[model samples]
Target: MKKKHMARGTGALVLVTGLAISAIGNPAHAALSGQALVNSKCATCHEAKTDQHWTRIGESRRTPEGWDMTVARMTFAHGVKLSSEERGAVVKYLADTYGLAPDETADHRYIIERTPSVVEHPESKPIGDTCARCHSYGRIAVQRRTEDDWRKLVHFHVGQFPAIEIQAGGRDRNWFEIATGDVAKELGKVYGYDTASWKQWQAQKHADASGVWRLVGNRPGVGAYEGKATIARTGDDRYSVAMVMRYENGSEESAKGSAIVYTGHEWRATLKQGGRDIHQVFSLGANGAELNGRWFEANNDAVGGTMRAVRADKGVPASVLSVQPAMVRAGMRTTLAINGVGLNGEVNLGRGVKVIKLVEQSAERIVAEVEVAKDVASSSRDVQVGRASGAGLLKLYKQIDYVKVLPQHPMARVGGNGGSQPKVPAQLEAIAWAAGPDGKPGTADDIRLGAVPAAWSVDNLNKMAAEMQDTKFAGRIEQTGLFVPNGAGPNAERKYKTNNAGELKVTATVKDGSRMVKASAPLIVTVQRFNDPPIR
Candidate 1:
């Protein structure tokens, strides 16, 4: 979603005050209760009954961030106006009363957590084709709203993407009508804001999230890093943070940022690191002892990593934070170092992995030379130091059952020098995963054995793709999965005089035992990115 920037000016405030007076008969403004404030400000345009329930207001719940966006939209798009204090009270009231149910967010955590290489399928076919066609379903499912708001959102879409009405399913029937009518109502019913869960959560005491924390994070292309963060409360549920990190290669960096914690558990931060903006979306653990989330480059959502933070003073148990060269090839001997806290005593590197020699030992780290058996089956195993165990922290794999294409669904822009814009290529990586004992594709037992050598190829996803001559015009995928798109603009060499865009499929095949296992993901050859935000 595009970020909304609030307009600032005395003129805008004056305009808002005049609108407020016209909407609600009251000219005097005072510190009103949340309900009273909503009744006076929002209920003027939105219908409100005697029970204090506003038509659209009573039907939905949202995070503080979501409510903030909504209020901004109302002021900018609908001409709703209120003082800063009034806006805060309204947002707080709405978020507190109408926030997300834990159950509602359970299935869609992958988006919030930004787990890498994840492929999500929509729950309904209509939603998949209509809503998820342009973006992820998580973006849609994450918010709650009333039928009116849902309808308004549909209108907003039609206004923004005028061609949507004539595209694919949109042209199949009364798409706009259905989307603004039954579909909107259905969405409101399923993802409505009011729920018993919100009430329960609102009544519970929230943990204070202020203090020093130890952080461990992994960026896909950059490897792993360790850091420390010091946070100080700035306002109610808001904080300022400073952090420093050290990469595996001894490179160091630092950042300063601020964060807002919505619903007391959702922590979102914007930090300036290495002169670039970064967005961190994390969930404060129930106990408030840990923070688990993802941090990404604000302009490119794909360039991010899994992040975890633990309270520095909580006296955490001995745990392995990371292992150098996380994965090793079968039959190869390598020196491995396990880094973490309270590391001592003899370390066990799991079965099929034998320690060749102890290279180093300390209270916070352990290094040893290890060897892996060539015939060992691929799987993640536990690494132990006395009684403290890191389960599934180490892997000893001999073969890969399937390969995953990173950024599973990627868009490659056609290259050109006309606008002095070099074509943006998609850097793809094929990660190998070892099938579990069951030899199944989807199961908890499946283990990511890490990046491995694989043969790469591109093809058409369907008959229409083939008819479009995607194989001939879309571009090509190298043996390493790096996709370089065709030149931009209309091509006289092709049947259709249009930009060489097409729907393509990327496949990675690997040799596993006596069989060849392969995996495929979708790709789109398209135009260049114009406004590249840090997170998309």
Candidate 2:
């Protein structure tokens, strides 16, 4: 999700701050003192003796990215102008002095580490109701700021989302006042920037991040993948990376990217994968032994997963990364390839799956033609190589009894140039999982059988959707579960006489044994997204 900002606003505080900062004539290469710079540029509006204004600034710290964002907002929204060199000096000073205490981020490291499929929320009720209503709590908790900055954030919300004051719990008496006052103060007290941790972190030496590494990642509904990455230092704090990944379904993808490390910890990258842009956010472990974070599609934050990389020399023994064509229809003959390491001996393609021919064999890979019996039941079993002594690294499923539409709550935008901008379509997928013993649904024991063939369709999700005729106006779903939305311009012929946007239900059905098992997922067809960040 994109961070909202005030579009237009003016107040006595803004005027004073602008004039005071501008009054300090631009200087050429004055000694880079953070305090002196702040006194000349900000003290007029903040008044150092106010206790909650300039004094608060002196007491708080933040990450380099955090400080950069704040400085950018001040320049563009609050008229705090500075030369490029002065801006850099100011950011460096603030980040180095008022940065996050090492212990401050210990509990919430997952926010920067990007642990996959984890759900987190703030313990505070008001924070949950107000802040988390639009974005993840981790986004708010990961940053360190002063009470003054926190108060500004509250005002920023009010200016950007005016309806927030009258929405749900926000409608309570003095909601806005409390948010800009007590709530901000409390947050600053708990998440303050200055601490012994930051001092210690700043004094310690950081590890160099350019090297070869081994990586493993897991995307929900997409299974697991493993790869090798080569990182080369391109600048003092920038790196270029090349990676090759093999997915559980036997597909291989190559990616190239560049990254900038901030404050010696945050790793942000822009990568290209399969002709599409992907953004990555990772944290370099203090020990320099690993980099843990998340990578997602640049257009959609929801389509991402956990990423972990360790020095290649420190990685574990060779093992199977994934099996190609993990699932196959029973009674059909197809070529199967097992890709991994240590595959020198005879291969077993599991029970109920017959090995028709051995086309190729090697210590690290094997290719064979296999056939499943018509009477085989829908089940998953491991594939072993080199008999019982060899490694069992693959799973072959004979049937798909159930289908799940991935991204349970999908949001797709209508496409057209008529509105703010043309929208991007959403790609969907259907995953097949084998039901466990007793045929119960939604159990922990259910085995993911990988992607399978399924029929797809769309319908209105509610009365509003039906009245809007979304099924007709919106896009259609392909057999592969991809949703292609319609244009965004107004259509006088439609019932709503607006763009093709509404709530939709996408269903996927597959034949399991003799019965058809199906799953439906909610989808929202909406307006164009303006800010598409790497991680939401």
Candidate 3:
């Protein structure tokens, strides 16, 4: 008996796509001779023996036209060497065994599925793998195109990837015609290409804001002094800034930076500067300021300098020579939120501040300046008791009171000081935090004032949480007060209410998973009720 030439099916033919097959003849007894005959001559070039040799197309049974196309593909694309007689014989054998039945849907599907995959087709890779890396491959394949349009993408890729080799030389314009026409032919056969639909797709994907640069801050304002910036997705990953800085005397100087920013939800830019090609990373925070990184000398030692990104759109004017802000107190942290293209040069806060610690928030950094708030405290004598006289603001700055960040939910007070009389309450409404000399808010030295309304802002909460990074709600001020006033004066009496006050017993409960942490503070809301004169 002739050795069974039961050649296994080629894997290239059988993709993950499960194609249905109709049984033609009994393979157990049919033609072992046909396999041997083809192998002796065709195997030398066809390379397909068992499953391994089957071209991606061969797995499907196709019509005569399809078979003819495959033969062309193998011979022309693969350089398959076959004599005319041998090729005729192989075609005859394949047709007799696997010819499509006229009405079978399987035959049609097989024909369709036999179209080349991206790897098998050279043109598909540029659109499929390269373009698809950042976006969808459908984005490119669906575009309606002229030969020129197709060539543009080809040229673009060749330019960007550099490793990509296009058939066209720098000046050879005709190469587009050849490449696009070939691609169009293949696509027409495979997807039944519709030019109109393709053009619509291209228009949608290709048309975007080009050449325009955007400067987006986390939120609004120009720099860190006003309020901390709130970063978003776009500015987190990419930051583009264009600015023409006008000097104190009104002379313009240009500053531009196009950077790839890793926002990580905060704003920080890794920038490449001109001339020296130096790379620097700048971190920004809320308000009207910024902090810059060290300058690396071209392949040499780096010297660090403070960079205060002054929001030129607002703030008081200063000398043009100073790019950094005036530091008021040694340790005062500041942040900036920049949103426009033009900024004033004098907005940098450079008077008497020293950066003590820096905290990163998304793309910006919170530059903490070190200054003692005690040195800057206005009152040296016996402090009066009231809600004004700058005493309330000072208490809030000193973090002597605890404020409820979530104003909607007031802390439930129990047994401490519960009375309708004008007296100090057992609990306060908000929490206050210490302020550095530069006037930047710091974390609370300790939880003191219980539950006050003034400490409900996100900024205050973040400061109260400090480096621990534990706070998640946004709040608004409901009330403001100072149990200890700055000074006593006739004008301050009405403004600072030193008379009837109500006391509160405040209880705070913070839950961490299954564990609960609780604390309490005494609060007083002063009210002027009596006009009785005091007799000495």
Candidate 4:
């Protein structure tokens, strides 16, 4: 990972990221393994142990990016010089030796995925208002540390970011004491270094990642895609990958790259597709039965899709991966696109639905048209094709009562214009909500109809925004629900020569029959963010 600096700000003052992974141990830095290099170089400040471990280095564990940030911080703050090759080796070494268990990172995958416009609600308000204000709750939860180490981290934060005492809610009380005494204690209990999952993971045998994988996922704003990935072992813990994917419109794209498998399960691949750099962060499932993760643009984390893949050979079981839309209205005719591995035989959709037309059927995909009974009860429906079955793959609903916008509150940044910083855009989607059995909207029983087509537009958020004509200057929302922010830099034509910044409302208008269902989300368009660490 390259060095990225957290700018000088109230939140960035805390040393969360902007760390550079440097060379470890030997001065010549040649002909040495990653561990030996780390053991040699890190001992300068951190005391080396008899068992080839360092003081604080072995006291905590994190993901690859977390280790990258820690080492990068050493390079940035402590002036450690690290080469890209050395950084990769050391990161691989440390991540494999001291990495979080898959179970530990289950709830915090969003941070690893670098998802955008997420509103995190930390279980503890103090942690949310204090530490999370600087980064994300997932960034904190992704690491496991001992109680003593946690306490020491609090002290380090106070020493580095003295403004922590005055930043937002930090000024209200004794922040240091609360952080060291209570917060650290809570974090230790929740994110303890010694966990059974980690122990089991370390002891368990690792599966090889060389095989043909059937991939199925949806590219946001685009459509559904089904593909195949061929992985071949190239070296120790590394493989060469090739993927060919076909979208719903019959268009195809292929990507080829080299991948590194970390901690047995974490699969990281850097590839080129359609003349653009891309990356895949997927986890190889048990016995290499399945691979799950996402692929995103190298420069933009928000532009990506959810990926689920199953092994295509080596006696992999027949599986029904997914059923598109998932939900259908009663008394309606729907076309279902089924994606899976080795799909064949009978097509079964639980009660009140029957296949009327078989558009296409193959070993990997099956397209069928089905008719839904009008009197069918609203309930969960299973989908099965031959030996493969997916539970609760379909939901029977009566009507769509309303529409809603995801990421109810979002933030966009202006950037680019013969500059380095790229503009950050908003990927918005409109969802149709069905009033479930209770027939009342906004209840727990409401069902989601996924992404629906909508006319996108932006308006001033409030009186001040209206007076400033914020919508006119901020950016434009495309018809496909994509909000592209304006370029960075000050506009001399604007009042006070301010940059293109505004508080706007993103509105999605969906035409359902004669009724026009509409929904709105607040969007804040601001100046460029200079500090963008992977974990943020």
Candidate 5:
């Protein structure tokens, strides 16, 4: 066996042992390549033993964030010292080499994009009981491992948590046996390390990201935005992003950022908008023709929204993705911004809606002032931009009979009193609802009139919360429907002297005509989430 000594901290050294293998996968120039760093640094820990691949690591695969957390665990738990650049390289190398296929992660994209308030329930109960009962089902679903590796993982969990079997669900049966016998096999079958999909991915050609792209999405507090993004290749798999966003309110803003693409399709970027930092987690579409995911605030992950982009290069199909000011109040002249690709032609807002004026025109966007007739029925309208038609893109509403808060309930944490985890704020939106043909709000035919401005407030959730005065201590809701949690700690004065956690309810009041429509949702502000892995 060849021994390699690696220095950690100041004087300590870790001894690495590995036998010579017939073949080795070479990591390229480290400064320009992540594989190189993996060979020079990570090789000391994960020995190359099986079939010229690293031992335990070679048989396992994960998403970029999963690999990132694994590397971060080394830095935090093993006292391994790595510069941020070096760490990123290692993660990139591992993820690219042993990354999951695009379809493998398709079902769990919400967690990858840091989407707020996602509740995932896997189809299998044994898998759920054995693994997901502790963490997110997505964490297990997006990962690949061999049957032996799965068993080894189960053992490791028991070794670390000790009484995990008893603590996980009910201790009615042989939990350990079930985990090793049934759960491991099921996990291996569902998330096999060597699959036909991975083989196809390995042989497929990935598209370059440098080019022009059409973009559209709705930001919660702000209205819908239509724009274009230009990406230029700065280095291998790295891009410099420049974007021009035209909000429906006739306001425009530009942003620039840096991004690194992992595993070909996984695109992660960090950008600043109006001087506030934001992050983008997107999946490049098949053939690099499009991308979809979410962009979020750097300081607060919950305070962001969804975005989708399509390659607008030459010969691309004309497609209409979204329309700005989607909700046109009856009897109002609203300028609708139609955003998409290859945009050109007469703008149609269905019957009873006339395009009185064309404000602006471009290949990516068309702005037109349209007047909605006062007698127009409340229903979803199809928008036709030139040859591209988007069904249900426009919603014309005559009245808002009710308002419903997006994310009816969500879990938040109290933090920032010198705690490691930052507070998880909840951003809510009050969406107006029309009775539609059903003449009732909760029916399947109800038409959503999009988001409307609302007054935000919080109240005690229940009798226990009211008795404890939880609303007085929990947090404050901004006029924009953003809930900023109070600092974490045990209070000195109060009943029972507890932490600032609270059971609360959030209310969004929308003023429609003279009647006030209010919608309330549950909000549980409690102790910090014990773990928030990238997959979770």
Candidate 6:
């Protein structure tokens, strides 16, 4: 050096001295001076100086625009605080020194030695030299990926900064080879290529989905109720599950149900009700013959439930063998004038996958589920009325004697041994459907709800609330459902043998203090139909 001048606190002097000492011990240390600069700055977020990263930078040969985006990402996304000018300079340096070349400079070995590694060789940012500047090495190495994948990722890092200025006497490809090629080769052989090691290393993050269930349905105030379902798999053919349907007030109502499948034919279920423990049993007939044995919970329960799944119609579970049914191969950008008041949305392909999701909701409208595939997607919306409207409708039905059974109403069936027919409980039951694409309600079909109509308004809600002023958020109500004693009147008997495709309409006007609102909606009911008993 031409009379080396001492600059205090520069750290340059100390760094140079340290390097000299390190070189004395191991000459290879001398080739990494430029990497040392990157280590002091760029490595704050990236990995170390390694051949893998250097090679990536060499191949990009990016223009100034590329470097601008890269630096902006660092400042915006990663919280790097470099000034705009500084970022520009760094990009210039990289582009000049390592930009792609027509010669063999684009080769991997040429760039690797030019790059640096994370301080401790993290699996994610292994070739970043400034790794120690921010995070501990242990936090990074948990990810598992292949060597080639790692190489490609390293390239992304270098391309992000294209304006790095060229430095005289800067060693390039040869330097890169020693750091990345040799070291990574050794590490890969030692670590193997799989997630097993990463899992073992990060065993703390493992999770199990025991006792998780999702429940869904459509009832006035009953959007959906999800809770733990007592579950037990009965040998190979039977699966038993029990869940409590909770009301708005948070009181529990037990719904004990189980499905029994015999041979490879169909599945059958019997549902019983109870306060704490179930007592009676009522068989629910199946729509699909094979349904007697196959019950797919279908993310329908809240995060906890035991649903013993049985193969209803199986030839090796077709859903698993094929690609997702919703994937689109090709289609025109055709628009369908979506009908139904509460239903409007668009489905499109994103990147390479199709994503279908709700984009908006209209007044009183709720989408039960949405799906778009290739050229087909279903959208829906519906309205929800307030408690006042619901009470008003029920009262109207009662006034008109439209309600066939009285004991089911809490007001009519207060005392013990109250009514002849099975009482309708105060709690919202699973939505019973009347008609769908196939036309039969409760006959078993997927019930889809379009958007809520404007009919379900704050004014309507207020009006409905006013009607229930006496009830006043009473929380939980005690009522029974359609329970008929043995020797009851004709209408009083629980008619399990008959499937009645009944319908329910409700209009409510609710009051929020002085302001009033109104809402109305429709409901469907499916009752098992009973025909003339055989004249045996």
Question: Pick by TM-score: which candidate is best?
Answer: 4
lDDT accuracy of residue 418 in candidate 2: 62
Can you write out model 2's per-residue Cα lDDT over 174-243, one digit (the tens) per residue?
8788888778877777665455666667677777889887677765445567777889986545578898
Please state the error at residue 13 of candidate 2 in Å. 29
lDDT of 3 by residue, 143-208 (tens): 333344444545655555564334223233334344355644443343332334323322332211
Residues 1-536, candidate 5, lDDT per residue (tens digit)? 12323211110001001211111111232353455555666668878674226777678898877777666766765676666656666666667778877887888888777778877778678888778877788778878999999999899888877988888564877888998998899988888788988877867887799999988888887778878899998766778899988777778878888777777888888787767778788889657888788988876788887888898888788888898777877898887778888888888878999999999998777879889999988889888987888899999887898999988777678988888668888888899999888677789899988889999989999999999898998889899888888877787765899888999999999998888999989999988764655556
The lDDT per prediction is: 0.68, 0.64, 0.29, 0.77, 0.78, 0.27
Give the clashing residue pairs of candidate 5, or none. none
lDDT per residue (tens digit) for residues 257-365 in model 4: 8777777787877788767787777787545667888778877766777888888885678898777767787999989988888888999997889899899998888
Model 1 has an lDDT value of: 0.68
TM-score of 1: 0.71
**Residue 241 lDDT in candidate 6:** 61
Candidate 5 wrongly placed segments (more than 4 Å): 1-33, 36-52, 74-83, 168-173
Whole-model lDDT, model 3: 0.29
The TM-score values for the models, in the order shown, are: 0.71, 0.68, 0.17, 0.91, 0.88, 0.22
Which residue pairs of candidate 4 clash? 19-72, 19-73, 20-71, 20-72, 20-73, 24-37, 25-40, 25-41
Candidates in descending lDDT order: 5, 4, 1, 2, 3, 6
Give the TM-score ranking, best first.
4, 5, 1, 2, 6, 3
Give candidate 4 misplaced runs (Cα > 4 Å).
1-32, 285-287, 325-327, 377-380
> RMSDs, each prediction?
8.1, 8.9, 30.6, 5.9, 6.4, 31.3
N/CA/C clash count, model 3: 91
For residue 319, give model 4's deviation from the true position in Å: 1.5
Comparing 1 and 6 by TM-score, which wins?
1
